[model samples]
Target: MSRQRLEHYLEQMTLDEKIAQLLQLAAPFYDEVGDEGQITGPMESLGITVETVHNVGSVLGVSGAEKVISVQQSHMKNNKHGIPLLFMADIVHGYKTIFPIPLAMGCSWDIKLAERSAEIAAREAAVSGIHVTFAPMADLVRDPRWGRVMESTGEDPYLNSLFARAMVRGFQGSDLKNDKERVASCVKHFAAYGLAEGGRDYNTVDLSERQLREYYLPAYKAALDEGAELIMTSFNTIDGIPASGNRRLMRDLLRGEWGFEGVTISDWAAIKEMIPHGVAEDEREAALKAIIAGVDIDMMTSSYVHYLAQLVADGIVDEALIDEAVMRVLQLKEKLGLFEEPLRGADVVAEREIIYCEEHRKVAKELALKSCVLLKNNDVLPLNKNQKVAVIGPFALSGDILGNWSWNGSTELTKNLAESMKVISPSNIIIAEGCSIDKITEPQIHEAIKVALKADILVLALGESSEMSGEASSRSNIKLPEAQLQLVQFMKQLDKPMVVVLFNGRPLDLHGVYEEANAVLEAWFPGSEGGVAVAELLYGAANPSGRLSMSFPYAVGQIPVYYNHFNTGRPKPSEDTTEKYVTHYLDIPNAPLLPFGYGLSYTSFTYKDLVLSSNEINETDSLQIKVKITNEGKLSGVETVQLYIRDVSGEVVRPMKELKAFRKVELAPGQSREITFEITEEHLRYYHSDFSFTSDSGRFELFVGPNSRDTMNAAFRLKK
Candidate 1:
């Protein structure tokens, strides 16, 4: 399959055949077995025929080598050209051996581990007949009310960019065409879908060009730079028009400026929704706008399949656009080696052995270990295994730990908190379901109190159900459920040393549990091995090394609070300041309850001896900064050393501090290491008022520390 061959095939396709090649339908539409396999209702609703199903370009939401082979064989038999069908799915976190959600993985801050997780996910998915994965979202999330925040890495562009590249490399590998165990990466929700208004899913997004370039666009560019194969258009609007039909976003910027020559597909029926979005009058206009805006594939929409050919025949839309879109689709199929081997890597035997195997489970456990952040501790962690520990809450024995988008993962295969604890200390662990995720009864409370009274230590497993976060699951109040809080209050009266192990998707307010518990572990939806990982850390088998990627607000009023925010003219003077008119909350603190990069380990680390090579540097030169970190505590642990820089003055307003670099160091007791970071001119660059990315010659401030708030500071100067 060369370009000439693809062109020859394109020349042979009829108008209906070409239009069919640009439409993507789900798995049920193409099932030729019986009435059970066919979705007759949707088929009639979309007005598609059997001939159209035979000629469809791709299939989504279908797996298993047997089913995919059956559908492909049937489709090619009826399809006159015998072109292979591309299979895509939302393999977000993991395929079978589920790993932590993207937000939890970001807290690990280990690029190599992140890449390995994606590699395992691809290996499992490729064997099951999936060709493309809509994952590594690359959306910079600031507001937690957005249910899709679980899909994003975090709030910072630089950190998310690093992870975006790791995921792309992991999913596609070095050579996607030759790698049978890898799947094509589709970095999704192009251009700021995470900034949805009111932190609601599919809400409008409005930002300035400069603001978009500065903070929102970097991660997407990073993914494309890493050679991702496909890009999915977002559902939200950019500027005024929806992203799927916005020419400036898709054609001008993504294809023209960024030089992305890959296939572009609309997010689930987004092109058809443009009619209701008030941008298009009907499906005919929607189809016209989407294709002209450079959307190559219309997902789950009849707009392209039913109307594209008519638009071209009417002379309003050029046939070249259809040719180009079809050619890109064909080129992707060829690149995937489908022309040579139509059933590329789908093997039933391999799918069974490679998915949820022992080796993949080990990596999932390791990532889970690094992702559970120790939010609070008053010397009650690393509990003695000999002590009688009561495990009580909805998640104590429940297997809803594998968060959202884990469609292929089964709860029965997961080990819950109670099971893992019993494995470590069978005789010393007692379990009770004190309350459901959102409800509790009087008998349940009484049973919980009785169980707590018998144990020396209480390990309350509590948090939101898996449904509380991840796509279309937003909540206005991000606190623990009222019933669970009441359980905490009743248990607090027992006066036993209590530890709260939270399994959640987003950063929570933690009002009741934070103040009452002696220790709090933020085990955010820690996938298949979440139970084992948290249990190990509890009994000194492993250390808590995870940090917070997103900030935890003290109250819901502080919705958008983050460490990288800009300074205000009427900024709050100080924590102790009693100023009347400063930008301080009347009843709450301006700072978040837990800031980004904030976490606690079993051991302690100290930072000192900050040194700078020189106080000033020119544009072509680089500056070297060094700091010494020592493991002061008796136990061994990992520490994340963060580097931040502040531009004193710029043509436009700038953040108080921006994360420039970070490195994780492992050390034993009393071990000291000198960490060095080199800062070049590129690290100092920022988007100007006119959207030009460049650095200014001015005084700069540098800080190095474990987290955002607690840091050692220095000064420098940048000269042009």
Candidate 2:
């Protein structure tokens, strides 16, 4: 249908029908076989009529082509207009063939891989009758204690924004109106959801608008810039106002300032929670505030369904607001081509044939390999295929490697490390579960040691469970569980070579684990094909190329440690001998155990010849910078060349270094390549003290190398 047709349909809607278009409900509300009381329990509790259910704009958490076909057929039978309901779900990582979690995908530092993963996910989800996926969560998370960090791309704004754009392009392809395998992307947790207080989930956020614009808001804007069709309001309060009803945030900033005409939906029941947030007196007030604040859809809430029509009637809310909100919903449905074909891509035959097929599984396996970060390697990796290997730990034989937010994925399809190792070293492998994840007895350790004594090498597979690091699963202490550490302590006494493979969600304080093991691989819950990928890396079939996207702190006290932190007035002492009156730690080093972008490969790379085209340049002229990189080892590898910049002086305090651009290049043994980056004036623009985008005339320092810490540097000037 055309825009004019959609507008005509919108004009014909009654006040109740228009208000219902701004409400979303769960699958149970429209279940055909469920009991009447069970189906309507949520409605009765929220005081919504059954009529509102039949007219709802969309449905959440429902899938399957048959069921969606039934619901759409039932709703169209009761409604005067033939508008189809949009189906949305939390297809965060994947629908069936689960890929690595978002954080792990960030570690890959390959934008094309990230885009391909989302493309595959969209294809799988569309066949199952899902129209929009609340995914590509572009929150910039520096604090690992916020369990939702698992769903975000890492700490860097530039990297997160890149991933955000790629994910959006992948989900909503250029031809969304005609694409049958695509779904609309929804970038979520609008306005600083990652900066929750004390790194707690749903906690308050208080930051200057400049700080908010500079750091937290760019990723969402990047997604919107890529034409993301929807935005979900965060659950947290921003500067004493909840994001769901913050007019300045949603109306003035998102719509007026950013020109984002996409439909804005509330995060799961966030609009109704405004009552508990002490901002609204009741559900009626909540609905009034959210509608006035420009929230288009109330997810899983009756506040809008029950009171929005009455608010328009009483003049508490303008009727034009309802028209605008309903128009956006109708526009989205038209773009989705729902009116022409109500069951847009709902084909039962396609769902069965494409759900977890071989092609999707292949991409999942490659992503699992690319996502695994080799944090430390001491020539002990690339173990001989014939070596007598021992796989021992809590996760050695467990299939719990599929991480959080994998709603449609199953662990039953996942192979354990021992099961995968059997293919490479069939008769010489010994496997034992050293202990349970959280606890271990002496007998279990003895059995593990006996198995370890028989093998020449040990692969200790361990880390947090999938339930330990997502949504309300925050941890006060970001360390390995005691049982795994104790098991490590026992294994350290052995003289055999040890390799520690971690399956976790967040960056862990792995100082002790690194000390005990000769080699460590930070494999953050590598989905269904994780076991095979680990085995391939172990036997030299695939090179280890993944890098760390988030910094691993030395201790829990350094919770918010990141590479892009601002320089302090009294800088931390570089040397331990002069620690007095400085920001140095008395017990540990001030640096992270492993810095951001820090990862080891089977081969080594050397950086040299940092060059700048000019010593100074005007604001309009592009500055050229180049560096030489050489693969000095015998194995072929992929190198992620990172470029960082620092302003010598600025209107506000500047970070030590901020990542500007990165390139991933493949190099053969003894191969050398020269990479160049152009710095435009736009790259230098940052939010000033007055919250205006401007650049100050100053000297600039540039660094280029493998990671953040160890780099080759040069100096240049930016003139007015």
Candidate 3:
């Protein structure tokens, strides 16, 4: 029988069978590690049985093609409906081949690399039994305090949009149903979940409708356009409704208006937590709300399996809702070719041998190098081989180089910064554990201070752990934790040259580092080969070109900082000192430590003469903006050419500027290129006051820059 006919026949079975089809259980990853190194704990002992799994439609965390096939054979051996279960994994960066964490990939700003990484992840995952990935988060985030910024691209909707599309295409490939290596792409957190209040994880998100459509919605829509097969609801609510239970966000905006013909899944255990969200009175109400809102999969929440069928029978939810969800899941399975020989691509030995393969490592290294943002360089970097380098801080020798959220990476397997630097220049490198991360005791501060007096240079590796900034990880103070600040101050007292290599998961207030360290590298948890990558860049083996996709704040008090924030009528410039009756804090300036799109390299470049192809254009026409960039330094280097546009006037006031396009350009010394970025009416479109997307007849300003703050401007007009 055809897969469609089988799906139809299954739909005709008892409501019990339909409920079984929508249920998915957590599956354990086959690779075993010691208790401390495992990414997640076992779900096997949670009263899970083959009978329960047989009643489920999908399984997550299960891999190894042999294991997948074995499980399939078991399902066929006992599953009453005889349905094949789909396997999913995080598979964010790469399956087992450690790549630069997603934030590091953001620094590369290369869609092709993102796509290549995803393709490789798919290839490895497919070898085992994985068919779906909860990746390419595509959430437009600017708050560095929110730890998952490491998983997203960055603040700008445009760059984030491109990254999102690339990731979806990479995961899904050209055709998903027929390609074994290609898994279904799940575009996540459907709406404005990124704007969590106070940069807190799972916090309330309240955004204006224009802010919602103009910034957040585009990336998800772009990912969907690129054929994302699943959508995951965010942990937060839009307004007062948790996204999992909101009909407007899930059913209306996503499926009804956007036409996303895919299964909507809740974030792990979200469906059951609707009671805590105060949206539902009980688990039964939560199940009804989520299903009615078009959520198909419950993730780890067994609430759907326990209460959904009864909800339908009680008339709280329609049987049609069940059918709608079942159809989407079946269609996706058919797309994956699961109906015809479910184990078609299953090759357990090949999967085990190939996962985390070497070539993926090479790509990961290249990406890691690209993601290292040079925040500050005062002619102190490009270290001379003759100079003795004093590497100070707990992060120096602690091979806990694996960034946060690495499920299975251990310090034993991970390379420490000291080791990678030793590989670079063994004899010249000195070491001292300045202090532990948040270690208030400062037992070794004297040793670090002593090393500082003798060494010609220093590399201070200090930052938070992988777990310090994800999921429930929210910080009230995002400064260098504890003695780290005191150590930097102590090192500064030595009057020697130093570079602070920060291995943090979030953007931190590096005011102390900026004052003391000669150079600063914001290495936001470069994964696996991070040590090697940072060492190479520090030694001038690789020119530091990674730019800050998110803004760095001066303090956690300046939370929710970004480049495109709406300009207030009483706009306070950096120099504005009128403390009386202004939208300004009496003590602090309304500016971040490092503006968005800010990153520095060894060599300097200058942008001159902003020119447009034409001053005016219609909605369909393209306006070309060009700038001549000179590599005004001795060393050859790369520059990320950024293009930002502003709506001078709108029905609703727009932000000062919005990032439209950017490109990473490599130039030899004395070489100049007039790079032209094409701007279209499509780029001009923004959500209007009435919730309609339209481009208006208005004067627009084009801003070109090394970073958002360092910019040159010109004007153009777009007509109806």
Which candidate ranks first by TM-score, i.e. highest?
Answer: 1
TM-score of each: 0.99, 0.98, 0.94
Please provide, for model 2 over 1-720, each residue's C-alpha lDDT reduced to its tens digit, 9 standing for 90 to 100: 677888888888898898898889887776662322223436775577877776889999888888887777777766678878999999888998898999999999989988999999999999989999998899999898888898998999999999999999889899877998999999998989999988888889888898899999999999999999999999999889999999999999999999999999999899999999999999999988898899999998888878887887787888999999999999899889888888888899999999999998899899989989998888899989889999999888888888889878888888888899899889988988998899999899999999999999999998999999999888888889999999898998997899999999999888669988999998898887888998898888899889889999888788789999988878985845665787777887888888999988999999998889998888789988889889999999999999999988999999989999998988999999999999988888899988889888989899898999999999888899
**Per-model lDDT:** 0.92, 0.89, 0.81
Clashes of each: 0, 0, 5
Model 3 quality (TM-score)? 0.94
How many Å off is the CA of 243 in candidate 3? 1.1
Q: Count clashing pairs, candidate 2.
A: 0
**Predicted candidate 3 versus true structure: per-residue lDDT over 60-121, tens digit per residue:** 77777766777777666556665677887787877766677777777777889888888887
Ordered by lDDT, highest first, the candidates read 1, 2, 3
- Candidate 3 residue pairs that clash: 39-407, 65-128, 97-356, 177-335, 404-466
lDDT of 2 at 658: 94
lDDT leader = 1
Q: How close is candidate 1 to the true structure, as a TM-score?
A: 0.99
lDDT accuracy of residue 22 in candidate 1: 94
lDDT comparison, 1 vs 3, better candidate? 1
Q: In model 2, which runs have C-alpha deviations exceeding 4 angstroms? A: 33-42
Q: Per-residue lDDT of 498-559 in model 1, one digit per residue for the tens?
A: 99999999888889889899999999999999999999999879999999888999988998
- lDDT of predicted model 3: 0.81
